[model samples]
Target: MTSAEAVPFRFFSLQVVRTRRLGPSLVRITFAGPELRDFRSDGLDQSLSLFLPHPGQDEPMVPIELGEDWWRGWMELPEDVRAVMRSYTLRELRRDADGATTEIDIDFVLHGVEPDAAVPAGPASRWAAQASAGDRVRLIGPSAADNRSIRFRPPEDTDLVLIWADETAVPAASAILESLPPGTRAVAWLEAHHAEEAQKLSVAADADLVWLVSDDGAPAAIDAVRAAQLPDAERPYVWIAGESGRMKELRRHFVNERGVDRRRVTFVGYWRQGLTEEQLREQGE
Candidate 1:
């Protein structure tokens, strides 16, 4: 919420225009609709709530209106009819030369959900794995005129940038990297479960990217962040996202071990190792 201006949340009905497999685990779903023109996404780490349909359901159920009290209205709906709401980062946004938004891209992490799995799949991942063109869903996004969900806040006169992200945070990290101003100095350490998930990243800043594949039985993700050598600067900003426990470790390393100002570090827990997102929300995480 630091970068974008204030705007009331708006409801938009979006349909899948295409789907692409970015890697072994990342599925890029492009959504398009007339309402998308009204959706304002201020690049870095912009997130929105998606109302995805439950399994075997034909359509997503959304409230008639979005207002300041939208959560109360959503809670009033029957659980069975209500859509499965989830938070995701806006990976990319495309606009025409005339300044009209055309398409929005979201990258969904497809955690291994085998057909004969012992447990059920998460609703959002299940939807992404099986979704196709013309499939519709709903979203609570920002208005074109104003937005407030982008939370990457670098202090004035930022000199050094450091980042740590797991698979879940890769899309946001990638978008942030693309938004860096030329001559910005950055270092990113990415943790991936498999080698294929480690990707070639493009950044405008002078960045050093280290991809850590854990399937080879390497050290913990936090250890990787701890071992990396950060570029020295007068004012360094740290952005980190990953599993909850890992994020805590990285935050401590930056703030306590390295003596970085606590306010300059932004850490978000995209998920936990054992807990589901619902559980995370219930505990007020």
Candidate 2:
């Protein structure tokens, strides 16, 4: 525990305090615990590792007591026994009057959860779909306000901000928009599978938000962005996140077609279509 290795991020034991449905495909689960007093975040798109339990288990199984070796120990467990881990962005954090974090929210996309869905829901999605008060979980999150996990960084000189995100990345995009300074010029295109999946977002920036509903035959994400005209600005910053293949296409459109400086653009592939989290981890290794 004295190693300073866990200073930036550490394990937190939390329980579901409540749940709210933001849209047809989106659910917000709020968690609270004494461990949250140490949970610090600058909030815009802060990322974390969430560990959930399989059905019939009361809490996630994680060998956090192993300290820095928790990952290796957790991985050594049987696939079915080991906690199901997933990466997610912080939607928001609530604090007490003394500025101590009391509860934190994470938005989950309930993909494939419907009875008539084309595909079946994964472990995390299933758990979230049924999450209720007192359901326990584990999270490896930032203990510092400014950490590397928060990736929405726009250069100080950025005069125009552009963003594009699919359903999977709407939470991150929404958090980023809320953090922008008032009067900052930004344009964001957010894609949703159904019109009911669209949620009202709050932002201080002079941001124009466009909702692209797939059910309504909205144009392809790249095509929509490419066809729109951006306001005049000398320095522009672009951020795109979603399915890996589509994210790459948007990144290229921003860097090559839009002529935005590659250094100023931040792109993240939240998930790849046709690949499970376990499969993606295997490929990465």
Candidate 3:
């Protein structure tokens, strides 16, 4: 799923049609595009690359016809007009009665800002915080025929599910949880800054939710996962995400301490603790 050659890509020019606040730190951005009619997803933790314009730019200027080679083309553009690309999870995919898809939702975490206090500081977060209808952005994602890049691939024998995530990965985890089959058993340890960051979850699966409010002395995501106990199951699958350092610790605990098969675990380090996305990319993280 991490390899571009493994799953093909498609580009869409989406216009912001609506914006809403999902929580104190989350904002929902709804986008519409003609190409979206052919858009499809695996429904759990689907991610896409968004090319957002700068403050003064009305729409993001991007390269075209790159297809799988798009990254190279985008990287070659001048920084001033190239636009900033950020990866985001698909929160929800809506469809109409005739099975025609409507709009897609992406939840953005307003980082470095308080609940209804002030605008977020990050480029993506700030854009989302003040997003208005008619704003246009470029997205590189999966088309209806080539959405294989989605990373929620659990084995058929998966029985017990274990998950660990921070606020940055909550939207992806929420989509995964809500899409779980009825009667499935799963345990999740989610980290957040405050209680207001917790949103209602709609899961038919038998899920035990553990919310760890991150603060002065709160347990980290890895510590929480290490301290918890998973239910009995012949085959268990783990999906852990968020900061790279914490994920590395949790991966060791599951594969070494619990004797879980490394092949059965699907882990993603969305970002590093003390590095920006640009830094992560520059170092080939």
Cα lDDT listed for each candidate? 0.81, 0.88, 0.80
For residue 149, model 2's alpha carbon misses the true position, in angstroms, by 0.9
Model 3: which ten-residue window has the lowest total lDDT? 1-10
Instruction: Please give, for residues 1-285, the per-residue lDDT of candidate 2 as tens digits.
Output: 443244988888999999998877789999999989988888588888899999988889998888889878988999888999988888889999999899999999887899998999888989999999999999988888999887788888999999898887888899888888899999999988888877787789999999999899999998899999899989999888878899889888988998888998888877788887667776871
**Displacement of the residue 214 alpha carbon in candidate 1, Å:** 2.3
**Where is model 3 more than 4 Å wrong at Cα?**
1-7, 65-70, 114-120, 215-217, 282-285
- The residue pairs found clashing in candidate 3 are none
Quality of model 2 by C-alpha lDDT: 0.88
Task: Judge candidate 2 at residue 78 and give its lDDT.
Answer: 94
Give residue 161's error in model 2 in angstroms.
0.8
Task: Give the true-structure RMSD of model 2.
Answer: 1.7
- In order of TM-score, best first, we have 2, 1, 3
Question: Which pairs, if any, clash in model 2?
Answer: none
**Model 2 lDDT at residue 219:** 98
- Worst window of 10 by summed lDDT in candidate 2: 1-10
- lDDT, residue 269, candidate 2: 79
Return the TM-score for candidate 2, rounded to 2 decimals.
0.95
Query: What ranges in model 2 sit over 4 Å off?
Result: 2-6, 282-285
* lDDT for position 202 in model 2: 74
Candidate 1, residues 1-285, lDDT tens digits: the string is 222235556778889999998766678999999977767656478778888987777778766455566666766788777888888888888987877678989988876566765776787888999889999999877774335666688988889999888888888998888788889999988777778777776777899988877776767777777777778898999999878888888899999989999999999887788886656777877
**Which candidate, 1 or 3, has the higher lDDT?**
1
